[model samples]
Target chain A: MYVGFPHMGNAHIGIRGLFKALGILTIDLPPVNRLTVELGAKYSPECSCLPFKTVLGNYIQALEKGADCLIMLGGCGPCRFGYFGNLQEKILRDLGYDFKMIILEPLDWRQTLRQLQETFSPVSWKQLIYASRLAWGKTVAADTIESFSHFYRARQSRPGIITGIYQRGLEKIDKAYDLASLRTIVKEVEGEMKAAVLPFEPEIKIALIGDIYTLIEPYVNYQTDLKLGEKGVQVERSIYSSRWLKENFIPWEKKKKRRKMLRDAKGYLKNMVGGHGLDTIANAVRYSREGFDGIIQILPMTCMPEIVAESILPRVAEDYQIPIMSLAVDEHSSDTGLQTRLEAFIDLIAQRKKDKKDYFLSKVHEAS
Target chain B: MKTKIGIPRALAYYAYYPMWKTFFEELGCEIVLSPETNKEILDLGVKEAVNDACIPIKLFHGHVSSLQGKVDYIFLPRLISMNTERTVTFCPKFLGLPDMIAALDTDLPPLLDMRFDFKKGKKQGFKGFYEIGKQLKHSYWAIKKAFQNALHAQYEYEKLLAQRVTVQEALAYLYEGKELSKPVDYSLKFAVLGYPYAVHDRFLSVDIINQLRKMGVTPLTADMVSSKRLAAQAQKLPKDLFWTFSNQVIRAALYYLDEEKVDGIIHVTAFGCGPDAMVDKLIELEAKARGHVPFISISVDEHTGEAGVQTRLEAFVDMIKLRREQ
Candidate 1:
């Protein structure tokens, strides 16, 4: 059976590695673009969130490319992400596509294991363990490379140098057959990124927080990170695929970091509003305390959790004396508008820094 | 003299007000319910609520604001589940209602945020209610007796709904302690599916029930169906929906479609509601494919106008009537 899954940033690399290790043929969907958005919007309900539309578009494209089975994550509500699997299945069936869907629901490992067993029949349990380890390694490697690229992009003297390196790094990771090679390539890439010469120090550091889908997917959020990096601002994102997997799937590790974030968020949000809402508030506070110049919250339009986060964010921003820009994106979110706002926000951060410096100088002069 | 406990007339307030009111009153607390949703309340809610929250959540903010200075404590329960089923859960906003209210930067009274989840059977629910009673300085026996009375009142309120009375009429009867006879059905019966807040709120829904009646259409809501019937209908799907209210709405729609008793279906969803987006699509697809039932979806928000709703309702009814004759 040929397997396919929706594109979530660099997750397909890990997923593809897992399927290959299990001796399964896999087809990866084409990268998200305007065409994908349009296709998804056409078949999707008018009000369905942007991520759903894009992912549905991805599935349709993959199926058209001869994928017979699809794998997707499932959620159990308070958010719309949980229902995407069921809704997409109905839509595809209504459109007369013949395919199978495997939804990996949280806390339902038995069902997931059963589905896995059925799909890869005659495979040993040891092979399953090997596949999972390889997949997890790929996820960690991809996130690391991406994070390093963010640092390089902000500091590199030449524009597009870091992106070129990132692309090549991803290609090498994809071609690597085992954990050893994957680790070697990741280390080599990190060394290369760090060795690159820098002409100037980064001016401002901003924390990127919000809905995971929009924050990670460049095409969905108009490549906000690259744009910010181009403007000489260092972007530090709170959520990454590996971190998310660790927090959700790994039971013991879930409490330590996330609990601290939640505790930090307690003064502002006070509850889990679902879908990274608490994360947004917590990260905003954490970033502010870490001396970050600004915070950017990017979420899809009409996203419930982020909306709740957005409401409480202003107070957090006021209390912490940090400037925050909340961007609610959808199919209609204009690139030019985003760029304009982002530029203005960066300029505001620079102005604030200078003003603080000047005020300190004045105080020192008065004391002397 | 007793402490005044404020209750917002939005979200689950339409469904569980009787139980909450009876319980608090039994504990010697005076209930101060925010007035029915009005423009001022709606505006306040809009202003205070997050920009992307649905109309009902915003209205809840409005109701809370209306009672801000008038009461000692706001009773906003974190209702996670009304059903014992593992998959069933309330909306995320409902789960986070008390926290959201507390974050609103208003000088509000302290909140008596109780949690209600029937996952571990009625024992957990009892523990929650008992905790609330304890906070109010009530004895264990008094709390137990009050809990029994609250349950009985809630059961009676639900009975009125099962007998086909609209929530508005049932609530009126509840307040007046009078029996409300079910109204006689009109010629064309239309199933109106939506969340309690969207269907019952006069301002948000623009009184769609009365508008349909004026247009000579009898409107049946999800509340009119029994939980057992809804559960049975829900079982027909491959997997039960994980949301409590969405499950009820979808099951009610399924019942109407499967029974083929209603001429058409009108689904009212709050603008930007996550679960309704899925449920609405499912109902629309089912209604069209299986029974060829005429389905109209109306989205309500702060910006929705009365004339547009009325015009659509009239047009939908007229088309159904025409189709019936044809």
Candidate 2:
């Protein structure tokens, strides 16, 4: 059985590595592009959020390439994501596609294990352990490289140099056959990123926070991080797939940070509005306290939890005196509009920082 | 003078207001209900609420705004689960409503934000009511009696629904203690599916039920169907929907198509509603394949024009009528 999964940043790379290590055939999905978004929008519910449509489009593309089974993460509601598996299955069936969907629900270990056994029978416990380790290593390496690139991209003298290095780093990590090579590539990339010459320091620091899908998927978000980095702003995203995996999949790992974030979120939001609603609010407050210049909240247009978060975010921004820009994106979101708004927001942050510095200097002068 | 308890006449208010009213009144609190949604209220909601929120949630914001500074405490209960059979959560807006309202920059009364999760039993719900009673300084026995009364009233109100009374008519009768006129038979039956707020609110649904009635069509809503029957019909699906109201609407549509033999289905959903985006498609697909019934999904929002809705409804009804003749 050839397995296929939707692209979530570099998650597919880790997934492919895991399956390969387990000696299984897997179908490489085509990278998400305009065609994927168009196809997804055509088949999806008109008002369904961006992630649902794009993922559906990805599945269709993969299915055409001989993928007989699809693996998708499942959620339990208050968010549209939980219903994606069921809805996508119905849509695909209606379109006359033949495929098996394996929805791995969080906390449903028995179901997950059963599906895993059915898919990979005659596999020993040792192989499972080995494959899991390899997948984890790939994910951590990919995330570390991507994070390093964000810092380097903002500080580098040339515009595209860091991005080029980051892409090459990812390619090398992807080609690595085992843990040793993956570790070597990661270390080499880290060294290269560190040695890069910086012409000037990043003036503006912004925290990216919101729905996990839109935050990670550059295509859906119009590559806001890249755009921000190009404008000499350091972008720190609060949500990362690697961190999420550690918190959720690793049984022994305590979610101390998550608990603390939720506790901080209590001042603004009392309940789990589902999806990363609490995280969005909590991270906004944390980033503000940590003296970030601004916060950008990006989510799919019809996303429920993000809407809730968006509603409460203005107050958080006001209380903390931090500027926030919320971008509600959908398939039809214009690239030019997003770019203009982002540029204006960055300019505003830069101006505010200069004004604050001037004010502080004047106060010091008055004291003297 | 009694302490004023504000209740926004949106969301679950149409279904549960009678109980809340009775319970609070028994606790020596005078209830201040936000007036029926109007253009001004809707405008306020549009201005104050986040742009992406559905019309109903926005209307809820309007209701809350209207109650601001007029009452001592706003009774905005966080309804997590109305049913115990499955983990049927409400929409995210409902779950986070109290926080949303609190975060609003407007001057607001203190909120009695009690959580109502009936998944286990009335024990949890009663505990919430007991907390409300304590806030009002009522005795335990008094709170218990008041809780029993509220439940009885809610039961009676539900009985009206079981007998096929429209929610508006039932609510009027329940509040005013007036007798409802006998129901009139109509030539065509159309199952109207939506959340209680969307369907019951005169402003939100554009009075679709009455319009259907004028066109010689009887509207069958989810509330009219017995909960047990709806649950049973919903069980035919591969898995239970997570949202309680979404599950109800899906089951109602399934029942109407398979059992009620309705001529057509009119599904009124809020624009950008996540649950409806999924459930509506499922119903539409089933209606086409299995039942061969014509289904029209009406997506409502703050900016939806009444004329457009009317035109679409007329066209849908006309097409169904022509199909019947054929």
Fnat for the candidates in order = 0.56, 0.83
For model 1 the local lDDT of residue A104 reads 86
Off by over 4 Å in 1: A255-258, B177-182
For model 1, what is the error of residue B168's alpha carbon versus the real structure, in angstroms, after optimal superposition?
Answer: 0.4
Clashing pairs in 2: none
Q: What is the TM-score of candidate 2?
A: 0.97
lDDT of 2 by residue, A128-205 (tens): 899989988999899989898788788977778888889999888888878999988988998887777476778889
Docking class of 2: high
Give the best candidate by DockQ.
2
Prediction 1 TM-score vs. true: 0.96
Model 2 spans > 4 angstroms off: A251-258
Best by TM-score: 2
Each candidate: RMSD: 2.0, 1.6
